[model samples]
Target chain A: MGRFHRHTDGTVHEHEHPDVRHDVGDHTGYRESGTVRVEVLENLLAENDRVAAANRLDLERAGVRCVNLMSSPGAGKTTLLRRTITALSGTLQLGVLEGDIATSLDADELASLGAPVSLVNTSAGFGGECHLDAVMVRSGLGRLALSDLDLLVVENVGNLVCPAEFDVGEDARAMVYAVTEGEEKPLKYPVMFRAADVIVVNKVDLLPHLDFRMDRFLGHLRDVNPHARVIHASARTGEGVDEWCAWLLHVHGTPTQRG
Target chain B: MCQAIVDTVTAHASGRQVRRVTVRIGHLRQVVPDSLSFAWEVLTEGTELAGSELVVEHVPAVVECAACGERTTLDWPVLVCAACGAVDVRLVSGEEFQIASMDVAEEVP
Candidate 1:
């Protein structure tokens, strides 16, 4: 017969073989055995989720609605952010947290527009993680004036795969998919598409130059994320910026009409 | 991600030599198992977990319709209900990322 012991630390040690020692040595009353089954049913991302939950509570307490924006590289996320900041500067107080593997070039650009921005260079720590987890977002939050801001936007490191897995405690998750990237992106990177609450099809101005089909793209997006609000935009010509800004205002529960 | 795994293994299986480690990953997690395995090999080169086998179990995503209560094991990216065609569906499983158990070679005293 095998012996089973429960430790105060919540670890269960089970000795399945007769040759295994119930009490060989050590203060824990369990010794080196033939094969010990240590049941550790713990999530690997539990720590991250805990930190994310705290971040959510912190943002909620400050009455700041946070949005996490994720997309592939060269998806016009920074351009969209710049336009949104310029459009909503007078209507709502906005702050941005920009995440990058290296360089604060995007942050500097946003700051030039007179927007409050914080830069999180992941290359500085965690070995340049491709995704911005909750801990990194919390570090960025420390540098921003949360009390003075009504909306906080976190532009996640430009990657479709890893960023979708980590939740940074944002009230809404949005993604930008430029039409130049092709219509097959929604299916190719389904996780990011599925996780998004809103998806913006940027670079509509280039639609005439490219073979991107609107119906096929929307069909793929709807198949993966039926509830995601899809907005067609052209950051270069300021097309769809009004509707996008209106959606943002609506999400923030503020009056959509400008004074 | 590799560093997190090393820390977790060191914390739980301290004294013993980890021969193999099993992890259960959900489909919705977007973790590439092959990439993870490669990362494990690179990260554990000089550590105690060197040469340890990394076993992975993938769990398929399951979504439950909020409107019709239809459950489905999703093969594709489509999250809508198969039974009711309802757009309002909640994921019930497939976000799991956990260290299920480890097979360690105990040091004979």
Candidate 2:
């Protein structure tokens, strides 16, 4: 059989293939003969995963359990981390890797908590990356002495989408979901909601002032992730901070990679 | 994701002009094919893959129900099993994001 030239309309013809490009067409089954198909068969996230595994091993060797905290903007991730730092101070050696797009405001707030904090401003050199990948976390990891800390909380950039896509060598992933964000978020952004090991429903104190329904939110969340542990909390009023802190303590003590 | 594809293709192509790069993206990955192709073009402009094509193979989200013993492919992002509508289903597939293969121009003797 001669080499076939495929068209954008899903038609193929046996003829001499031209150098005409089809960048704007739907790339369904376009194939040619002069080109040799090389089977790479590699996961695009393989590079990120390899770095994440190395970061995990490094943290494990240091006897530190890391948690990746993610959420949408204004979901109170920083507030919860601040409260958690205050609640767990002196009891647990806490270290924070604060991720933000352009500002040090979050890092500034965490610095007063008396724990070692490493701020990873994505805008500095990362071309304003929306989420912190393993490479970014590794760059931040160097600033913190892992051996000196019992827990490392990576405050992923406040993005429910891209943050969930990248793994930064964390033992567990916690998502701070505010009640005001709407019940349909789980269904709308299932990737982020499903990736969470624990979903902290923040701003529950304002539940009375809003039209948010806990039952509906839980129902939707269950549809996406039935196994994620849900915790009702308010970072502003310090409610449920103890429960959140206790969960962190428990996760820190547990060996994440025993199997 | 586009950046990852370019890097992978570049590494595998190894100085050869890339004719086409094939990638398999699961529905759960939430990648829009058009946006990916646009990004690919933007990233490949002026590079060896300038006029190269990006072939996208979309993988649907499939789940196996634990209670009903059924495997269903979902059209939406919801993870519920379509057979028995059970939420206690494990993901069978749909988290894939990989470069399957690439076509490079054959060397002329």
- Candidate number of the best TM-score: 1
Instruction: Write candidate 2's Cα lDDT for A97-175 as tens digits.
Output: 9999988888988998788999999999998999999999999999998899999999999887999999999999999
Runs with alpha carbons beyond 4 Å of true place in candidate 1: A1-3, A19-33, B65-71, B80-89, B105-109
On DockQ, the leading prediction is 1
Any residue pairs clashing in model 1, and if so which?
none
Per-residue lDDT of A125 in model 2: 92
What TM-score fits each model?
0.90, 0.89
Note the DockQ of each predicted structure: 0.58, 0.53
Candidate 1 DockQ category? medium
Cα RMSD over interface residues, candidate 1: 2.8
Clashing pairs in 2: none
Model 1 CA lDDT for position B91? 88
Predicted candidate 1 versus true structure: per-residue lDDT over A58-112, tens digit per residue: 9999999999999999999999999999999899988899999999899999989
Give the lDDT of residue A218 in candidate 1: 93
